[model samples]
Every structure is written in C-alpha cells, then in structure tokens.
Target: MMNDVVLKVEGITKTFPGVKALDDVSFDIRSGEVHALVGENGAGKSTLMKVLAGLHTPDGGEINYQGASTHVAGPLDARRKGILLIHQELSLSPELSVAENIYLGAWPTNRFGVLKKRELRRNATRALEALGCGFGPDARVGTLSVAMQQMVEIARAEAFKANVVIFDEPTASLTDTEKDQLFHTIRGLKARGVGIVYISHKMNEIFDITDRITVLRDGQVQGTVETANTDLNQVTRMMIGRTLDTYFIRAKAEFGAEVLRVEELSRSGLFRNVGFSVREGEVLGLYGLVGAGRSEVVETVFGVRKADSGKIYWKGGEIALPRPRQSIDMGMALVPESRKEQGLVLMMGGRENTSLPHLGLFSSVSLMNRPKELAVFEKYRSVLSIKTTGPDQAVSQLSGGNQQKFVLAKWLCADPKLIILDEPTRGIDVGSKSAIHELIADLAEQGLAVIVISSEMPEVLGVSHRVLAMSEGAIVAEFEGDAMTEENLIDAVSHHRGNVAA
Candidate 1:
C-alpha cells in the first residue's frame, strides 16, 4: 500500500497568527484513486491542500512524494514534481485566449525566445479534444461560460502531465449536465493513473465520484474510509460531528397576509412572465437549474433590474418603478449571490460594512454618529454570531462562513421588512449552512417575509413553505404540502409544460 501511495502527508500541522489551521493531519493519496477531502468551511481543508500544493509551509510535519521526503517551496516547485491544484475560484486569465491561458506559465518558445503561437494552439487543442471539450482553443477565456472555463483548467492539468491533481469545489458553479461531463473527465484521468484530491461539501458528489473519503474536523483528521463502505449519514456525522437529523430544524410558521406580489414579471430574454408572491412569515423558495433566471427575477423584484412588463404590489398598493435606493427605502433588502463583489466591501472593516446601509440612521446633517454606528455593528455582531477579532477587522480575513455572516449582519442591521437571499449558503460549510437555515426559519417565525433562491435540492425542500420551479425564464410549476417532492421539482424545472397559478 505504501508503495502504491503517490503522495503522503504525515503530521501536517500549520498555524496562522491566532489559529491552528491544520493540526497533526495526515493522509495518503495513491495513483489512479480519487480521494475526497471534506470538512466544514474552516476545518483546515484548504490549508492542508495549500500545504500539499506548496502555497503554504507546514509548521510541523513531513511530506513524502514517491516514498522520498520532499519540501515544496512554491507552486512552481510543486508543479515541477507533477502536482496541480484546480482552485474553487478558478485562476484563469480572463483576458487571454483559451490556448494562451492553458499554456500560460510554460509557453512553447523558439530558439530566439519568440513565442510559438501555432505550437501552443496545437497543444491546447489536443488537450481540449482529449477531454471532449466543445469550445474552440482560440476562444477568449472570458467569453466562455464558467463550465467551459473549468474544462480549460482541466485541459491545462492534463497537458502538464501531472500525476497528482486536486479539484477544490469544482462543481460549485456547474449545472447538472456539466457535472456529469466533469465526472467523465475525472474518470478518464483516473484510468490513466492520475491521483485526484476532491474537496466539496456536496454530499451526493462525494458519494458518486470519490473512491475514498477523508474527513477533517477542527484541523485534525477525523477518519478516512472507503466510499463504498459508508453512507451519507455516516459521512455527515464525521464531517460535523453530528447526525443529519439534528442539523436543520425547520419551523412550521403560519403565514399572514401577502406582503409582496408580482404579476407577470418579465425581463425580455432573461426571464418571462415570472409571477410569485411572498406572505408575511413565509419562506418562498425559487428552485431551478443554472440559467433558469432565478437570480434575474429576484433582481427585478429588488429593483436591481427593471422589469420589461410587470406589476408589483406591496401590501395593497401598486408601487412605481422603484430604483435600488427607493426599494431599500421601502423596507426591502437583497443579499445578492456574489457577496464579495456586490454585498460587502472587503477593504472596509466589518463595522463599516455592517453599518453601510444604515448610515443615514446614524448621521445628522451629513455627519456620522460614531457611537450609534458602533452600537449597530455590535448588535448584529452578537446577533449573527460573526466570528471576528474585533469590529474593525477586515472582512476579507475571515473564513467563507464568517464572511457570509458579516454579509447577513449588514442586511439585518438595515431592518428590512422583506429579505431576498440568492444562494445565501452557496460556498459556506455545513455548520454555517445549518445556522443560516435556522436563522431563516427563526426570522420567518418572527413574522418577516423571506424568499430563498437556491439550486440545492435539499435546501429548497427543507426550508421552503412553498416551492416554485423555474425553467427557461418562466415559472413552470408550483408545489406545496405533499407535492413538494424532489421528483416533482426536478420534473417541473426540466420541462416547460406545467404552469401553476400565481
């Protein structure tokens, strides 16, 4: 077994200024096997991967490559030893062509150092064709969709002749079809004896593709077991140290009168005739595949995008075309999908970011009230359980879950009557997801209307009082009570026949 191991990490312990990222963690990756590295958002999964990829140095431990002790000085050093990491946030050069990006750091050159564009394109095309990628090699990387760009990343890995390849949350941005394609490519790699280290929170994906599962908790190795021998419930227990039954506790809240209603909301090519309503104390779930216009419809309602033809009524009166400021002034809040780019200013301190929406509340005649702002920040920091050294700390320094909490705190401080969250728990860990789901349920119980837009089936089924399925920019079907099964939802989203009354 040791001889079969391509990479071995022994007692890998890495520490930051105030946190022990990876504590005495060890694992072995063998050729032709897919090893899944799983844990909560801050459980040192990324840290350990960085250590293996030479992005970070272990404070204590040893890494043995091919049964020999080794020290990876940097990414280039790791790559020199046939190790490649495909990050969750893709690292492609957007401005460059597909072929150029694939052969970026190691371009083919001539004797006089002139770039060999023809040879580079040829190699890139060969790599893409090997992976069955449909996009042309000369296409601009930025012009391609997220899934296609990911294919380019994989093609680059294959072109490098890497023995060990790590995929970090590869399917986070992909559709069901794209995921299938990715799995097929992974199988091809495995057949050729390329070791894979997959890191993801999606339970179904781990069970489907991974051969072995290694769980980490609190920076320590919890356990490693063959995927065929374990189930989701067991793996979930290992991941968060608890059973699945105890995770999300949904409350059955009685909804009050309709607070917001939309009649035939359309956004031209984006979404069409999308109609829905949210009642006080109700959680309305919008479910669909990628490009189903779920985000677009919500953006229209939130005034980020103007609807082509639609009528929106708040309570009983029809509202005019409300701009973003007007919508916010009318007690509406939207926690957009891309939190870092749209929700929070990463350079600003948590206190400043949290109080951004409510600055007018703490200002008199264009003068900011420091004490009042601090009070608002402190209130949400406590209520949302934001993990930060202080309110003045940069939000970017926090983990994914903590950053999401900070985003929620920012909106909660605004005291909105209706809250629309688009993929609220997209990249967060299981524990943070549980907390957010519970928070949503609690908010609904407290008489706040909530709309949750999510692609995850379990999340939509668990948290929603009513589920609306979207397909091809239209509301295909609506489900409630016993009809809100995953089968029904999938059928509705996949087909365009059923149309339920708004």
Candidate 2:
C-alpha cells in the first residue's frame, strides 16, 4: 500500500499572464503515505494543485488517478471520484451550520424533496468527532474562530470519505493543540490506505507528517526525496536556489531612550492589566497562542482599541491616545495582522500606499509631488528588495512577499519612533520571510523601537532581543539571552500562570 501510486501527473504545464506556473512538472502520491509539495511564492505550487483539483486546465499534461488516466473536469467531479482538497482558505459558507456546510449541495432527501436533516447532522458529527473538533454540527461556521473553521473544512472533506486528500497549508491558522489533532487525523487516514498530498511552507510540519518531499521552483520540479533522507537546509536550497547563510540572525544594538511604556493596560473582555514597554533599538517579541489576547494588547496600545484603565508613556511623557492619527502624528506606526484588510490599500499602487503616511512630505499646497512619491517608494523598494516592475504596479498585483514589503515600506516612510508589527510574516514564503526578519532587525538596528507579535515561536526567537510570553491576557514570562528558547516560551504560554512586570 505504501508504494501504491494513487495519483500521478506527468509533464504538466500551465502558463498564465507572463508566468509559467507549471512547466512539465511530474509527481506522484502513494497510498498510505504523505507527499509534501513545497516551494516559494509564485513557484507554481498552487497552480499544480489547482490543475489536480480541476480548477484550472493544464496547457499540457496527463493525470493518472487510481491507475486510470482521466481529467478532473471540475471540483464536484473530483470529489465524486473520492478526491477532496481542504484548501488553506476556508471555503465554508459562514451563514450555514457545520452540518449544512459539510453536506452542502449533496443533502439526502425523500421522494418529496424534504432534506434528511437528522442524517446530515449525524454524519457531520461523526466526521467532526473523528477530527477531535470541539464544536457540534449545529454550530454556525461564522461564529467559530479561524482555527475552528479550518477544522470544519477538514471535517467536510473527511465526511465525504475521500480516498485522496490534499491538504494545502491546512495548519496555517491552527493552534498547537489543533495542529496535533490534525496530524493524528492525517495518520489515521494513512492507516486506511488513503493518499495524502500535504502542501505547506512550514518545514517542521513537512518533516513531521510527510513521507516524501517534493521541491518545486518557478513552475518546475526540482526534485523529490524521501523525507527521512533530506534535511531543512537541503530542501531550502532547492526551493530558493541558494544557501540562506543568515536565515535569521540580527546583530545586537545598544538600548536607547524608552520609546513606549504601558502601565496597567486593561481592555474589557479582551485583556487585563497588560503592562509592557519597548526601548529604542530593541525588537520586543510578544508570543502567545491564538486566544491569548496578544493582538488585543497591541491594538489597545496603538489607540485602535481603547483601554479601560491604562497609562501610556511615550519618551518618558504620559500621553492620551484618542485617535490613530494622533499616534501617527506623534511618530508611531502599527502594521496590522491582516495585510490585505488593514495594512495596505490593495487597489492603490506601491507609490500611493507608500506615500499615505508621508502626504506632507510628498505634497506642496494640496498638490502631490508625483516624482517625490516615486523616488521615496523606489528607495524603500530597493532597501527592502521588493520586486516589482514599477511603482505604479498595484499592490494587489504583487506576490505575498512583495505585498508585505509594501506594508512595511508604507510605515517605514512615516519614520516612526516606535513600530508595532503583528504577525509580520504569517503568509509569506521562507525567502521573503527571511528577508522580512532581516528588515525587522535592520529597523531595530536603525534605533526604531519595535514590538513584534507572533504565534510562531521560531519567528519570535529569531527576530526579538527579548520575548514577553502572553497567556489569556497578562504577560506570564519574559525570556532573554540564554533563557530565550522555544521550549521555555512554549512552557510559559502553555503552563505558566501569574503576571511578571514587563
């Protein structure tokens, strides 16, 4: 069963809009084994998956599924043949219940056309329980958290009894606990001789759950090796075509004046008595679980969420933050968690988004100095190594890595005294993720006080000079120097209780 090739694609090629998404890529998924497909952004990972799922027709290729050469005409047709793709992006209808979403468009009914609601709920519950989902089938998908919604998506796939399951970044938004459950579920599927195509950028997950690792770069197959035979450094080299000598390294910078200090900050129903401070030339990391209220604390500090009882000190002077503009005017910037929603203007080009904070700098008497705007954006574009044909290229047209650079460049243009980056490198590729880490370090080296809020332990440890672990709401432990280990940080957030002065 382990050697049974259930899905095979040979000479697959797909091209679109000046990019060769998949160029004669050949791969196979074996029954009872997890095959990982990994690559950098725009490396054709998604394109290959889309072709397999019938979302895109390949320019040229042949697909053999279960020893039969066939074409998956559409998503329904793929699912009808026991092939299911649990996408990274949740596809469930928010308005529908878990049961409804699981059995959507395929509800059982009597001759009178009445739905078998009881059967649907029972089947949905069975799937959810198999995945150790906490919520019941009757719960509305919209009311659930992103992690829970992800679980529901997987449950929907499992309910259909998929023989070949493709999981693309399935653990992206999941918690440590939920990730464990998903791994267990994947192993259970393998035991039943199901073929799994696991795609993710997280190297640890690929190494842990996958039996074979396939590397793709710029729409071509680099190589595929047994997961046990390959290492992280080798796989990364194949993906980016070079050794990442300093994937995550930052030189120490001397601490300067206090940039921001929070005393007894409390937000009703969100966080409680959250006290922390950041000094210039320091990258302070805030590490916590999904519901640990890390983002809420930063939001409250940045004036987007009002604090119930708190004292904010900027440069040793007490301040009342009534609006974000006031904070911005006073030399503070917050790069939000969701880049698409809150960080940058998608419709606007790189120049426009970069100039949003520097309107005064690039304007004279209500008229924008277009040349100045382009010059400023070009400077940061070079500094951040953002790849784009021109400044007029829309931010939405940029890749995830390039788009994140625009967000950072936009705030960097403000020349803030302090910058708060929330989940800075969530969805970007490793190459871009490494570049952003270096940029964060460079920003700190340039004497800008920075606070990074991240769920990834490696990221927090890699970029921060010191880490403040948050649990529920308050700071549980502070790790610095030799104390800053992933084990200690995880322990602090997972088990440690009671607040320490931050």
Candidate 3:
C-alpha cells in the first residue's frame, strides 16, 4: 500500500535580490506525520515556508497538494484547501470575543442573514473543548495572555479542519506548562491524521516532536534524516555545516572588590526576593528556560521596572534607582534583547544610534558638538566593526549581526561600570556571536561588572564565572567552579521550583 503524500514541492526555487533565498528545494509531507524543518538564521527556512504557504510564489518549480497539481494563489486560497500557518506573532482580532474571532470570516447566519450569536458561541465552544482548551468562548481575545491567544488560533485551525498545518516557532513565547499544553494539542491533531510542518531554531523540541527532520543551510537542503536516527550534534552540524565554537574564551581576570549588590529584590509577578552581587571584573550568568523570569530579574536590577521592595548597593553603599535614567546616571547600562525594537532606532543612521544614549555628554551650551560626536562614532565604528555603507547609512539596512553591534556601541558610549545583556546573541550569526562573547569578556577584564542572561546553555556555561538558574520567578540553583556543564545546567533549569511568594 502506498502512503498518502499530502504535500510535495518539486525543485522549488526562490531568490531575492542579492540573496538566493531558496535553491531548488524539494520536500514532501506525508499525512499524519510531524515534519520538522530546521536551520540557522538566514538559512532560508522562513523563505521556503513562505513559498509553501503562498505568501510568495516560487521563481521556478511547482507544488503538488493532495496528489494534484495546485497553486496557492494567496492565504485565502490555502485556507480554502485546508492549509493553516501559525506564525510566531499570532494574527487575531484582540478586541473580539474568542467565539467571534474563531469563526470570523464564516460566522453562522440566520434565515434572515443576521449572525446567529448562539450558534457561533456553541460551535466555538465545541472547537475549544475538542482541543482541551480551558478558555471560555465569551472571553475577550485582548484580555487573554499570549499562550491563550495561541490556543485560540489552534482552535480556529481545527474549526476549519485543517489537513496540513505549519507551526513557525510556536513555543517561543510559551512557558513550560504552556508548551506541554501545545504538545497535547499537536498530538490530538496527529491522532486525527493531520500533517504538521514544524519550523524552529531549537533542537530539543524538534527531536521530541518531529518524526523526520530536514536541515537547510545557505538556501539549500543539507540533509534529511529520521528523527530517531539523528543525534543533536549531527543535526546541528548539518544546520550550519560547521564545527561550532562551543568553548568560549574565558579571559580569567582577577575581580576587584564588590562593585554591585542587590539585597532581597522584589517585583511581584516577575521576581521576588531575588538577590545577587557582582564584583568588578566578574561575569555572572543568569540561565533559565523561556518565561523563567531571568530577563525580568535583570531588567528590575537595571531599573527598567521599579522593584516593589529591595535595596541595591553600589560599592557597598545603598544606591536607590527608581528609573532607567537614574540607573544610567549612576553608571549602569543595558543591551536589551530586541536590539532593533528596544536598543536601536532602525530608521536612523548607525552614527546617530551610537550617539543617542550619551547625547547629553556631547552637547555644548545646548548645541550639539558634531566634531566630538563624529570622533566618538569613529571610535566605536572601529571598536565594534559595525558594517555599513557608511556611518550615515540607516541601521535598518544592515544585517542582523551588524545591527546588534550597533546596539552594543550605543551602550558602550555610556561608559557604565556595570553592563547587563539580555539574550545578547539572539538572531545573530555564529561569527558575530563569537565576537560579542569576546567583547563581553574583554569588558569584564577591564574591571566592569557584567551580567548575562541567555537561553542558550552552552553560552552560559562557556562564558560565565558563576551561573544562577531561575525557574518560575526565583533563583532555584547556583553553579560555580567546574559544575557548569551543559547537562548539569539543563538539569538545573528543568527541575527548578521555588517557594511561593507571600
């Protein structure tokens, strides 16, 4: 008996100007199987998916759906043929009720052509119930959390009986418990013989959930293997075609006397009673799973958010900072996770973004000092290696790695004693990641206190002198000396829980 092939791409190729995004890629999805598509950033995974979903028509080749030559003219055409794509950023009407949002385009109508609210609610309730969701049908989508909104999107897909579904980084914003719930839903879809296309940068999730894996690199297929046969190392090697530099350069430096300390930091719903200290030339890494409150802890310490109760000491004296500006004034800097959104103004040029954080320092008699500013830009442009057409080129035009360097340059200009990095290497390439790691170590060696919060375990283990593991909203474990291996760090993050805050 021949197995049913739900979807097939025959030598599909797509190209953007100056970038061959996809090169003669051929892939097939069988019914009732989870097919994982894995690759590093800029590996053309998103481009291939977009082509498959009809967001972009391939430059060459054809797609066969359900054993028939078909073209998905648009998203609506794909939806009509039982295809659903769930993006990382959910698409839903927030102000509408869950029931209304689920059946938005095809609401139940009465004999007089008026919307039948009762039937709409009943049908929506059934869809959520089938997916094991706990949300009420009448609940407003805007009021629900991101996890719940994702569930609603799944319910909407199920409501239409999607035969083929694509999940693009579905668990990026979800907690462990929420991820478990999503897994249950995926299993339910599998039981009903639906085909799933999973795309992600994470290895563990792909191995755990997918039946087969396809690795893409440089806009081409690297390899495809059975999930059981391929190990993480083999798959990672295929994804980047590389022997990765997992061992970071630990510039062992003699730490000076204590420079920063937090005593019983408390921020309700984020973290509470969180306390740690960093000496000059010390690198303290905060490691945890998504929603582990690692970023929140550092954000509070950097004064991005007001701590409900806590005492911060700089050089062993109480130093209270109520806002980020206050913290900046007292020699603290933060390179936020979303560099484009939070750290740099993408619409502006690189030199402007670099000078933004410390513009007041370059001002003379309420007028800007162009010469001094240009000199400062030249200094950082050389130091960070920010690739640009020129210093006057918009930051948005640069690559992901170069854009991240611009963010670092902006903060370094502030001349802070303590620097905090949240997901510092996120979405950046390997070469740039290495550069950033080296830069952080060099900064710490120069007698600056450094705090790094990263989701990547190897980075945390390789670079940090001390590691703190957080779960829920508090630190659950601490590792020092030689106890910071990848396995131990994963165990600590996976099994951590803390006392409930009063």
Candidate 4:
C-alpha cells in the first residue's frame, strides 16, 4: 500500500503569528488518483500546500516522497523531484510567448549558450498537444484569455515531467466550456499515472473529478473518504462541523417601499436590458455563470461603470449618470467582489478603514477627532465580531473573514439605505459565511434594501428573497417562493432561455 503512495504527509504543523494554520495534519496522494482537498478558507488547505511546494517550512512534519523521507529546500528543488504547483493566480510572463513561458528558466540551448528557438517551439507544441490545447506556441501570453492561460500553465507542468501536480482553484475564472476542457485534460493526466491534488470551493467539481476527498476544519484533519461513498451534505458537514440547514436558515423579513429600480439598464457588450427592483427590506439575489454579466450589471448600477442606456431610480426618483462618490452620497454602498483591490485600503488600520466613508463625522477642518473615530470603530467591531489585535491593527494582517467584516463595517458606518454585496462570502470560512448571512438578514430586517450577487447556487437559494438569473448579457429568468430551486436556477443560467417573471 505504501508503494502506491506518491506523496505522504504526517504530523504537519505550521504556525503564523497568533495563529496555527495547520496542526497535526496528515494525508496522502496515490498514483493515478485525483485527490481533492476541501475546506473552508483559512482551514489550512493552502498552508499545507505551501509546505509541500517549499514555500513554507512547517514547524513540525515528515514528508515522504516515493517511500523515502525527503527535504524539499525550495520550489526548484521540489520541481527537480517531479513535483509542480499551478497557482490559482497563474505565474507567467505576459510579455513572453507561450513557448518561452513553457521553457522559461531551463530553455533549450547549444554548448555556446545560444538559444535554440526551433527546439523550444517543438517541445512546447508537444506539451500543448498532450493536453489538446489549440493555441499556437508563438502566441503572446498576455493576448490569451484566462482559460487559455490556464492551459498554458498545464502545458508547462507537463513539460517539466511533473509526476505530482497541484491545482488551486483552477476553474474559478473559467466558463462552462473551458471547465469541460480542463476536466478532460485532468482525466488524461490521471490516465498517465500522475497524482493530482485539487483544491476548490465548488462542491460539484469535487465530486465530478476527484477519486477521494479530504476535509479540513480549523487547522485539523476532519476526515478523508472515497468520493463514491459520500455526498455533498456529508462532506460539507465534515468541513464545517455542522449540517447545512443551520448555516442557511434565515427568518423572513417584511419588505417595505421600493428603494431601487433599474429600467432597461444596458452596458454595451457586457449586460443589456437588465431590469430589477429592490424594496426597502428585500434581499435580491443576482445569479449567473461566469461571463454571464452579473458583475457588470451591479457595477453599472453602483456607478462604477456607466450604463449606455437605462434609468436608475433611487427612492422612486430617477437619477442621472452618478459617479461612485455621488452614489455613496445618495445612501448606497457597494462591497465589491475583489475586496482586497476595491473594498479596503490594506495598508491602513482597521479604525482608519472603517471610518473612510464617513471621515467628516470624525474630523474638523484641521483637527482629527481620535476618540470619536475609535468609538465608531469599536461599535462596528463588536457588532460584526471582527477579530483583531486592536483597532490600530493593519487591515492586511487580518484574516479573509475579518477583512470582509471590516469592509462591511466601512459601509455600515455610512448608514446606507441600499447595500450591494458582490460575492460577499467568497474566499472565507464556513463559520464566517454563516455569520455574514445572518448579518445581511438582520440588516434587511431593519428595512435596509440589499442586493447580493453570487455564483454559488446554495448561497443564492438560501439567502435571497428573490433570485434573478442572467445569461448572455440579459435577465433570462426570475424565481421566488416555490420556484426558487437550485435546479430551476441552473437551468435558467445554463440554457439561456427562460420566462422572465419580473
């Protein structure tokens, strides 16, 4: 049995400042197997992978490769031993061609150190052919789409003759067709006896591709089981230490007067004819597949992007092309999808970040009201259960969930009437997700209109009062009450043709 194991991890423990990321974690990967690593964010999945990739030196652990205990000094050392990691954020030179990126560091050269361009192209083309990638080796990496870049990464991994490959969130930015192509490529690798370690948040992909599943919770190994012998509910339970029912339950809130109305909103080449309304206490869910134009619709409404043709009515009165500041001034707040880049200033302290939108309340012409700022920060920190060393702690040092909480704190301080959250619980732990869901429900209960844009079917179905499904730049279907099932939502987004109830 040990002979079949390609990589083995035992008693792995890694600690960061004030946090133990991984504790006594143990797992194994076998040849010709697609092993899935499923966990909530901050559940030690990435930490453990970093240890294996030579990016992090575990405080305590034993790593055995090919039945022999080995010490991987660095990424180059790991790669030399037939191990390769394909990061979620791809590592490729945008200015270089596909062939150059594939044979990046170790390019083919003659004894005189002259670059062998022909041999480099031939090897890269062979690797691409192995994965059935259609792109030419001469194409510049930057000109390619995200899905095509992912293929190039796979080709590079094969070019290195990697026996064990790790993929982190490989399909997060891919479309349905691109995902199919990736799955086909993975199957081909498995057939060739390469061990695969797949990390993902999407449950459907795990069951579809993995041979076995391992669940991690709070820096510990919950369990590992065969995919054929388990279901999503069971796996989710192991990952979160509770059933999904408790995590999704929300009390109904009565809706009041309409607060937002968009009529025939159109952003050329992005979204078109997108029309929807949210009442004073309604939580409207916007559901769609990747590239279905859900984010574009919300961004247009938030004034982050200009709508070519539409009418935006706030509190029943139509408004013209308002920029982000004007939209914020009009009692609207947007917690963008990319929180790190768009939601918060990472270098600033929590107190400073939370008070950014309402600085006037804590500052005079030439003097800052320190006590008032601290008081406001403390109020939201307690309310949102944000974990931090102090109000002065840098937002960058906080966990993903705490950062999300900080973003919410910033918006809540403005006392907004309408709040828009795009992928609010993305890249966070299950515990934090439940907490945020409850918080959203609480805000709606207090008569604050909310619009949630999400790609997760369970999140949309569980939290929203009504769901609008988008496909190919248009609202194809709407669901409420008894009609808001996952099957109906999937059909609406995938089929791209359905009745619009709105």
Candidate 2: clashing residue pairs, number:
0
Q: lDDT by residue for model 3 over 46-76, one digit each (tens)?
A: 7888877779899998899998999999776
Q: lDDT at 180 for candidate 1?
A: 92
Clashes of each: 0, 0, 0, 0
Clashing pairs in 2: none
Best by TM-score: 1
Return the TM-score for candidate 3, rounded to 2 decimals: 0.83
C-alpha lDDT of candidate 3 relative to the true structure? 0.83
Model 3 stretches astray by more than 4 angstroms = 1-3, 110-113, 245-253, 267-273, 287-293, 315-318, 337-341, 344-352, 361-406, 413-415, 425-439, 455-459, 469-477, 483-502
| lDDT tens digits, residue span 1-502, model 1 | 3138999999999988778889999999999999999988788999999999999989999999988999999987887788998999998999999999988878899999999999999999889888888988899999999999998888877788888999999998888888998999999999889889999988788999989999998899999999999997888789888876756556576989888999988887888887789999999999988888899998888889988899999987899868888888888989999898899999888989988877788899999999988888888888888877787888887878888888888888777889999999988877788889999998898888999999898898899999998887888889998999999997887666334232
**lDDT (Cα, tens digit) per residue for candidate 2, span 1-502:** 8999999999999987756789999999998999999988778887888888888999998999989999999888888787888888878899999999988878878899999999998999999988788899999999998878877877766888777889988887777877987898889889989999998878888999999999999889999999999898999999999888887866476899998999989887787888888998999999988878999888888789888898999899998854687888889889999889898889889999999876888999999999888889889999998877688778887777789889999888878989999999887788888888888888888999999988888888988999998887778889899999999987887785444333
lDDT of 4 at 381: 92
Per-model lDDT: 0.88, 0.87, 0.83, 0.88
Candidate 1: regions farther than 4 A off: 1-3, 497-502
Candidate achieving higher lDDT, 2 or 3: 2
lDDT of 1 at 171: 91
Candidates' RMSD to native: 2.3, 2.5, 3.9, 2.8
RMSD of 1: 2.3
